[model samples]
Target: MSAVSPRPSYAAVLRIPHARRTFAAALTARLSYGVVPIAVMLCVTRATGSYAVAGVVLAVFGATVVFLSPYRAALVDRYGPRRVLLPMALLYAVLLCTLTVAGRHPGASGLLLGVIAAVTGACAPPLGPTMRTVWRELAEDRLLLQRAYSLDGVAEELLFVTGPLLVGVLVGFTAPAVGVVLGAMLMGVGTPAFVMSPAVGAMRGSGGVRKGRRASLRPGRELLPPIVVAGGVGLSLSAVDLLVVAFAGQRRLGDDTVAWVLAALSAGSAVGGLLNGAVDWRTPARVRLPFLAAGLGVTLGVAGLAPGVVTLTGAAACAGLFVAPALTTAYLIADEAAPAGFRTQAGAWVNTSVNAGSSAGAATMGLLVERLPLGVCFLVAGGVSVGAAVIAGI
Candidate 1:
């Protein structure tokens, strides 16, 4: 048999000099994501004594991000990420501070709190896209970029996991508002550094995208597939989230067991993303993407039908294995497909679709979970994933 392609070396990847700083800053910025919603929930509950009100406040933040991501990204493409990133990062902190301070007072109205949360999210810096842009700028070649994307995907998974844990620590040791406060601090420090890094500066100075290109909802003439596919991934994830909680409740798993089970799913994705990155693929990303999307849906369906936590975990892992590979490919494709100067906007559009899809999927799957068996909820997620595959193929 032919010897397997050599594993991509992480040491080599990190040796590029600019990589470490960008990675550090990107990870730092990501940590805040975990803290914000939970902190907002906690802060709101503390002040209003109503989980319902807190949930609404959090939802407003999510909705605002979905709509505003593309515009913010367009600005980054126009003026360079620093011009966009620095100001937004600072504003994000200020908004968080406003919300935090307002949350402390009984006189703060829900409308005021919700408005603050919305603005904070709407003006949030395009750090996620900016980092992806950095990777594209820094990677030596397509293969290296593939490795970078895979590494980035895995790191993101870890960030999501760690972020919540950090917030938990803060909430336990200090106060709920402290979590949001810390998240804001992370953004304030991390985003500016990330945007100002040498790799980012090189990207801005390269003048790849035209200075005056008009922003559009269109990622590019060619980017619609990846955008839709990303949306589907988001849709399935939200459904799986709800299903996992329902499964834990149905099985009478302890309060904390749900967290573990969810963590297992994410753990599987992280492992899969790392492994995928190490390989040299023979398949074109476009062909592989649909298969992976379809596979995730099927695996998730099977997992939903599983009878025990062990089986469910196995199934979840199988599905998770497909996620990063598909996402990495999509991001690569987006880079290729984006109109010149619209790189940031292209990433933002993909993000916007995913967030929008998530909101829709969560709301839709939520209604189904109320009426259907928990196993069927997995099937629903699978159906959504399959639809996403169809979009990818289209």
Candidate 2:
């Protein structure tokens, strides 16, 4: 009988030192995101007695981050992450403290909450880029980076799964403000701790500004376009995400369906990211861009069919096929586009673009959800995806 080979473990695939640190950082940051939804809802509801107001606050908060992520990223590359991280994190913690105290007055609470959200968004630290940078700096090969990002995606999904539940318990048993308190504590602990690590500070005095600025100027490079494409893709994805939940609820499916559907989406994205990482061929963005767009278009377009959970999940997977490759492509482009001095900021620009696109897609979908069928929303999202593909191909 032939001997069978055992499957390799993920850690073996990555083969990097202090990789667990990155994973730990991702966990804390993601968990912090989970806390925000609960905190915002609680803060707005207790003070204004209106869920709508609370939602608006959340939207505004997200918008601020989406808009500012690029700038913050640039700052990280220019000045090094440590300089940018501490101040922003400190500001965010301070805002949360203010929210805890100002919870009673509705007018005061709304204003404070919005300010806090904006500050938090701005100060959220350059985590995604910083983490990626760390992987690039430390990992022996591209394969390791792929594993790092895949693990990051999984960690993010877990955060969504666990963060809200913890928040619910805290709010239900104690107070919604508890979520804020917990998030702040985590942010305070996590952000600074990561920044203070010797590996991170070692890069601090290195050429952050010189490299970042050069990358920002080169338009012919791959980085700028992918970031643009990703932003649009992110927008569409966010819309589909919310629409799926809304449609499920309308069908009288339980809230539990939301988690399941989101899981499908996350699973798809993770799979796509892993697949992209595994491929060794160094394909140009122009070649890869169409596939990414087409995959998203098809996935999102089919989503409007509003099939059973199984069908919807399949569509989600199809759409997600592009997620990681597209991102990888953008990062590659950024690497090419950025001079040595501007590497980090160029990467951050890509991150910012994605956040902005997601914000736009969510807003546009919200408007559509009111007047159109859920299926129509899916079609619209798909069409937009197709358009993005065509544009990216050019």
Candidate 3:
């Protein structure tokens, strides 16, 4: 039997160059995203006046992202995340400017906004999954990779919590366009550096490892597992987003409400990831999958009972408890599942799944809100997460 190497000490784990770059990248990416919840919604609200219209606009944006993310991932795989990331980042920034300028033409605004959104969506950096791929590639120590994922979870939570509030403040105090421009600049500056870090470059150069490693990293290989897992998880996450909108719309919550609820959930997910990394649970994922399912079931089920924004956010937080760890594990699984030189595809597939799921969730919930109570929407969203957990179990 092949002996698995012993895991490294905490000190040793911290020394890995790849892990540091990932840490830096995670900080930047999440921080940039933090500004999005407020910036995007506020832009729509200011332009359209009606919350439903804003919601529809958001839904369209989500749809564009879902459809285009796979192609972006393909680029990442073909040229490396660095090669695609800078141009994509710059294009995203330009689109934000376009969205800002197109606001005055109500008749043509929606179409122009949608077009710009699609462009930005196509360029949205593949940081989350790409970073995960880098972690696996650069960190020889499994423990370090695990830590990086866990830290990433924490960073995501921080971003979601703080990002929207920052955007909200900017929109409220300054201008909606400011938020977009700033978010674009931050993303453009931060993501490219992360993608181009020395550590990430080193991993890209490992040409003659085991066949699986070579094939997974190769530019033109089909890696199906990451695609499946990413799609499933992304769909589940999208459902969660729909529920957030439902809750916000139901309570007639202001533009800031969605950001708060998402933040609450993010906090829980961050905690879960941190615990998972720290504990270094020796058990198989098969053992952990059931618990994740139960959490999803309970969290989503309770969200339906939320009577106000506070209760809704609370329930959402509970639901979030499973998010990061599940996502991180899914990335790992995708890496394991992919063939040589195809890691970027795996990451891209994950992004595509999320974008797709977000679009579907937004559309479904937006319609559902037209006919049902917010609580019911939450229940449905929660149900989606539970369903995802159950499917993962199988």
Candidate 4:
């Protein structure tokens, strides 16, 4: 056997021709993941003057887009990214434009706007997962793949933070609808470029990859365990997010400070992800995955009990450190566990599960905070983390 070469760094990884374009595309696509909510909120507020209406509208979009993913991903597998994504990207753009027009026109019906948001979002490009799939195909080694996933997690943290910041900037500089429109325009550019990339064209696929059919509607049982773990992770993350907000409110920190505090949590995660990428694990993924996940929960549980802002910051950082490693392990394992020719479906299910969990987290913690102390909300966040650990362990 030939000797193996060292895995490429994230910077070097991007220097590959197709990788650069797809990486850029993935950033925009994933950026939209966070951008859409704020954009929708701002658009609705500008048009209807009701944040409640905007929240409801955005919630509908989030709920719809997630559940529809498996089907959409199946299409990508069936027709390939070019045929499927091009149309979806076009439709998504049209919908955003339509939404902008509807919001600006007082004569436009709310029902029409809701329909636009729901359908447009449901059909949005599967940018994040698609990029992961492409990266796996392009990776030179398992270690490289793991590094790619860590880089993905890091990008996700930055995208989420940056997405809202960009939206706020757009809203300040232009009409509220401008943010949504700008997001859609970026999608229009990125999706087509990603699909048509010469690099994507050269990647080899297993002959088993084929068109999805009605009979293929259900994913293989191999996916069940990891998807459950992913959902739990998603749920725990959402709970932690809300709990942080509640913590900030309790400490008499203004809205302006909330982002600063959350930045500490995100910064820790980025560092952890970077370190994970640099290390080569000798342990089995099954053992490593659950261990990291459970360790995360334990850390979060202890941190939730912190009595002051300084303690809370340190605790959040401790919890944050585990976030990317667990996620990277889960993704790697899920890819291994996916059935033949069904990796896309498996990825979609993972996405769906996490999303479902996040929805539950928001709703569950929202209710808890209404009747229980803010500390209780933090405890619940920790509990959810533990629950994720258990599900992943099993």
Candidate 3 residue spans exceeding 4 A from truth? 1-14, 44-57, 104-108, 203-263, 302-317, 366-380
Is candidate 1 or 4 superior in lDDT?
1
TM-score of each: 0.95, 0.86, 0.77, 0.92
Evaluate all candidate structures by whole-model CA lDDT and list the values in order. 0.81, 0.70, 0.65, 0.75
Q: Which of the numbered candidates is closest to the native, going by highest TM-score?
A: 1
Give the top-scoring candidate (lDDT).
Answer: 1
How many clashes (backbone N, Cα, C below 3 Å) per candidate?
1, 11, 12, 0
320: Cα error in model 1, Å:
1.0
Residue-wise C-alpha lDDT for candidate 4, range 58-167, written one tens digit per residue: 88888788998887777766666777788998998889888998899544466677888998888788777677778777775887887888898789878888888889
Error of 4 at 346 (Å): 1.3
Q: Output the lDDT of residue 49, model 4.
A: 69
Model 4: residues with Cα > 4 Å off, grouped in runs? 1-6, 106-108, 203-221
lDDT of 2 by residue, 99-142 (tens): 66777565555766666666666666667767767666766555
The residue-level lDDT of candidate 4 at 262 comes to: 68
Candidate 1: deviation at residue 201, Å? 1.8
- For model 4, the local distance difference test gives 0.75
